[model samples]
Target: MDLRPARAHEAGLLTELALESKGYWDYDEAFLAACRDELTLIPADVERRRTTVAEEDGRVLGFTTLDGIPPEGALGMMFIAPGAIGRGIGRRLFEHTAAKARRLGFARLTIDADPNAEPFYRAMGAVRIGETPSGSIPGRVLPLMEYVLTPR
Candidate 1:
C-alpha cells in the first residue's frame, strides 16, 4: 500500500468509506444517518486539509486528515474501509499520521475518537484527556485523545 494525497474527486468515495468504517462499530441506521453530515468530506476538505489515502492496487484501504496550524492540530478524521479492518491498516495510518504531524512541527494532535476506537488510539500512544459532545449525535459524547508529538 501507498500513502498519497486524496483528490477532490474522491470526496464521495471517501465519505462512503468513512461511513462504512464507522458502521463497523455496529451503530444503528438512525445514528449513522445523523453522523452523515459530520463525516461527509466535501471537495474543499480534501483540498484544504492534509488528507491522505492508503491505497493498494489503486484501491483506497483507509484515509485520514490532519488539520490546524503548527504546534497544535487535530487528527480530523481516520477511517479504514470495513473490509480492511483488523489488517493493521489503522496502525499504519496512525503511525504515518503521527510522523507527518511531527514533521509539520506540531507539538500535539488531538482526536475526537469514537468510543470503539479509543483503545486503538491508546495503543497508538494517545491518552484520553477528556470527552467532547459529539458533533453528530446530540446526546452523545466522544473520547478526546491527545498524542504529544516528540521531536524526531
Candidate 2:
C-alpha cells in the first residue's frame, strides 16, 4: 500500500470511506443519520489539517487526519475502508499520525473516539481520559483519549 498526504480533491471519497467504515459497526439508520454531519469532510478541512491516505493500486484503503498544534494536537479523523479492517491499515495510519504529531512538536494527541474504535486506540497506546458529550446526539457520550508523545 502507498501511504501519502491526502489531496484536497479526494475529500469526498475519503468522507464516503469514513461513513462506510463507521457503518461497519451496524448502527441503526437514526444513529447513522445523526452522525452524517459530523462525519462529513470538506475540502477546506483537508487543506488545513495534516491528512494522510493509504492507497493501493490507486484505490484508497484508509486515511487519518491530525489537527491543531502541540502541546495539544488532535486526531481529528481516522477511517479504514470496510474491506481493509483487520489488516493493520488503521495501525499504520495511526503510527504515522503519531510520529508526525511528534515531529510537529505536539506533546500529546487527543482523540474523541467512537466507542467501537476505543479498543483500537487503546492498543495504539492512547489512554482513556474521560467521556465527552457527543455533538450530534443529545445525551450521548464519546470516549476521550490521549496519546502522549515522547520527546524526540
Candidate 3:
C-alpha cells in the first residue's frame, strides 16, 4: 500500500470511502447524510490541514486527517474503505497521524471515537479519558480517548 498526501481532486472518492464505513461508525441513514456532507469537504480541507491517503493499485483505500497539532492534534476522520477493513489500514493511518503529530511537536493526539471504533483506538494505545454524552446525536454517546505521547 502506498500512503501519499491526498490531493484536492479526491473528495468524491473519499466521500464514498466514508460512506462505506457506515457500519463501524454506527451512523444511521439520517446521520450518514450529514456525515457525508462533512466527508465530501475533506479534499478541500486537505489544502488547509494535514490529510493523507492510503492507496494500492491506484485505488484509494483509506485516509487520515490531523487537526491542530498538540498539546492538541486531533486524530479526526480516520477511515478505511469498508472492503479494506481488518487489512491493517487503520493501524497504518494511526501511525501516520501519530508521527505527524510528533513531528509537529504535539504531546497528545485525541479522538472522540464513535462507540464501535472505541476498541480499535484502545488497541492503538489511546486511553479512555472520558465519555462525551450524546451532544448533538440523539441517543448516541461517544468516548473521548486520548493517546498521550508525552507528559502534558
TM-score, candidate number 3: 0.87
Q: Rate the local accuracy (lDDT) of all candidates.
A: 0.94, 0.91, 0.79
Taking the tens digit of each residue's C-alpha lDDT, what string does model 2 give over 26-53? 9888988888898888898886888899
Q: Which stretches of candidate 3 lie over 4 Å from their true place?
A: 24-27, 133-136, 150-152
- In candidate 2, where is summed lDDT lowest over 10 consecutive residues? 40-49
- Provide the TM-score for each candidate, comma-separated: 0.98, 0.96, 0.87
* RMSD (Å) of each candidate, 1 decimal: 0.7, 1.0, 2.6
Better candidate by lDDT, 2 or 3: 2
Better of 1 and 3 by lDDT: 1
Worst 10 residues of 1 by lDDT: 43-52
Candidate 1: tens digits of C-alpha lDDT, residues 58-141: 999999999999999999999999999998999998889889989989999999999999999999999999999999998899
Positional deviation of 138 in candidate 3, in angstroms?
A: 3.8
RMSD of 3: 2.6
